[model samples]
Target: MASCIFCKIVKGEIPSFKLFESDKTLAFLDVQPLSRGHALVIPKHHGEKLTDIPDEYLTELLPVAKKLAIATGAVEYNILQNNGKGAHQEIGHVHVHMIPKPRPEQGLGIRWPTQPTEMDKLKELHEELAAKMQE
Candidate 1:
């Protein structure tokens, strides 16, 4: 973790364009930004991936991300968290990329294969997931 750039940022050993910080997380402007307001949200504690974060800390991450997006004047935003090498996770630290989507021509453009799901299939999938939820 000593070599991890995000950890260094959290520790203040390295400088970042810090936007927000709480007991559990820190938000800063991304050095290699996808857009003008692109920011990275990271847990104060070092974690290798999303699942590595404790549940308590994880709960605070998104609301902070939302607040940051609004503070940065992001008309819309994408919260991205890559988990492993196959998922294009370049950094070892668990950080969320909050990319401001101002216009179609701006920010990271993502391409994905689109498939249509039948209404019945969508309903079934929703029901199945809902049933599995503890709450």
Candidate 2:
């Protein structure tokens, strides 16, 4: 937490183009943006993954994200939550990227390649996930 940029922003040690702030969360413009009003919504407390935060805390984040998305006049958007480095997470803290997809000219979407997978493999994964969810 001492080294986290988001924590620094929350503490006012680092300057951020702030959009919204609540007791439990903070939303701010991304310094390096993918779109005109790209923002990052993060928990005020240090949480490294979705599972690390309580359900109540996580649920509250959506409305704040929505408000920022609408305030920025985003025609379309993606709420991307990255968990860890293996999933392209650059920072250790949990933050949702509010990428405003205003136009194709901006090239801000769906670029990650997907490949077809076997149905049996999908079924196996689904079964495993379903079992885990029940725990």
Candidate 3:
């Protein structure tokens, strides 16, 4: 956490264009924005991933993101959060991106690689997950 940029931002060790802040969360303009009005919402708690954050710290995360989206006057946008490096999370902290999609070419563009649905495999997987959830 001492070396984390987000943690530094939260601590005012690194200056940021802060938009909103609460005890549990912080919203600021992204320095390397994907599009206009792009912002980063992060929990004040130092968490490497979603599951690492406490529930109390997470309570204001989405609400801050929603506020950022509305404040940006974004008609279309992407609320993005990635976990691991393979998932495209550059920072070692939990943060959500509110990227305003002003045009088709801008903001977060995603490609959904769809796979063929196999009912038997899907049922078996679902049952396994369901049983785990009960435990």
Candidate 4:
């Protein structure tokens, strides 16, 4: 984590427009923002992805993001977290983006492609996942 930008920010080696900080989490304004109040919330513990971080480190992430959303006065927003390069995660640390959508043309724009569902296949997949969850 010596080269991780978020870790640098957490350690105060890199300067950031920090908004909130606690024992386990840090929230800051995104240097390159998509909207007026775009911010990033990160856990103090270094982790490249959600599964890599301990559950206790992750507990404050969403609560802080929620606080950022309220502080931004954004009624409509998107809370986003990406895991890897293929998922567009530029940083090698887990971070959540709180993007405020004040208008139709702003914030995170996504195209969710919908596919027609095959009920039997869907049911079988659901059961498979449910069985795994029990383990």
Candidate 5:
């Protein structure tokens, strides 16, 4: 993770507008923000994806996100976590985007695209997932 920008930020090699820090994680303002109080929350340990983070670290990570949300006075907001290239993950480190909604200029104006799926296929897929969860 020597070249990872987030790791550099965590290590103080790169400057960030840091907001909050716990033993396990750090929260900071994004240089390029979606909204006024837009922030990124990241684990101190480098993890490229969600599952790579230890559960103990994750437990501390989320409450910090909530703290940022409240500290920013985000009356409505979204918490975005992305993984893998296909999921639009620009940075290889696992981080959460806390974007306050109703920004002065409509915020980031992000949208979730949807596609239709057959109900029978959905039911079968759900059943398959439920079976997998037990394993």
Candidate 6:
């Protein structure tokens, strides 16, 4: 993926405020940051979605993300991953959005409208997901 920006960053062809790097992954400050320590965690290998990466790689990526969140003094954080074009994934390469939510007044403010799901629906959805996990 020569055209991918994240690949370029990983290759050192593009400059990034790099925070951490491993053999398989790179963590860097987002150029267009939403907050003081906003960062993007990406795989060294180019992939368009989470499922594209092997399970072992994903296992390694999460702990690094947690370390980054703690190091950045994030009181709360959002781990956002967009899968496709319809989901607003502007970058062609897959990356995790590590948004540090230090305060409600700072960073990206999300207004989540809560709607109560029916108990029957919740039970059915849970069962469906649980079955998938067992497979």
Local lDDT at 116 for model 3? 98
Count of clashes, each model: 0, 0, 0, 0, 0, 0
Model 4: CA > 4 A from native: none
Model 1 bad stretches (over 4 Å)? 115-135
Pairs in steric clash, model 1 = none
Q: Tell me, what's the RMSD of every candidate?
A: 2.6, 1.8, 0.9, 0.8, 1.6, 1.9
Best by lDDT: 4
Runs with alpha carbons beyond 4 Å of true place in candidate 5: none
lDDT of 1 by residue, 1-135 (tens): 899998888888999998888888898999888888888888888888888888877877788889888888887879998998898899998888889988898787888989998999999999999989956
List lDDT for all candidates, in order. Answer: 0.87, 0.85, 0.95, 0.97, 0.88, 0.85
**What is the C-alpha lDDT profile of model 4 across 52-94, one tens digit per residue?**
9999999999999999999999999999999999999999999
lDDT of 6 by residue, 1-135 (tens): 998889999999999999899888899998888888888888887889888887655665777778889998898888777898997788988788788887787677666789989999999999999999999
Q: Any residue pairs clashing in model 6, and if so which?
A: none
35: Cα error in model 3, Å: 1.0
TM-scores for all candidates: the values are 0.82, 0.87, 0.96, 0.97, 0.90, 0.85
Residue 28 displacement (Å), model 2: 0.7
Which whole-number lDDT from 0 to 100 does residue 14 have in model 4? Answer: 94
TM-score of 5: 0.90
Q: How does candidate 2 score on lDDT?
A: 0.85
Candidate order by lDDT, highest to lowest? 4, 3, 5, 1, 2, 6
Off by over 4 Å in 6: none
3 against 4, candidate with superior lDDT: 4
Distance (Å) between predicted and true CA of 82, model 5?
A: 1.0
29-100, model 5: which lDDT tens digit per residue? 988888888899999889899999888778767788899899988898888889999988999999998888
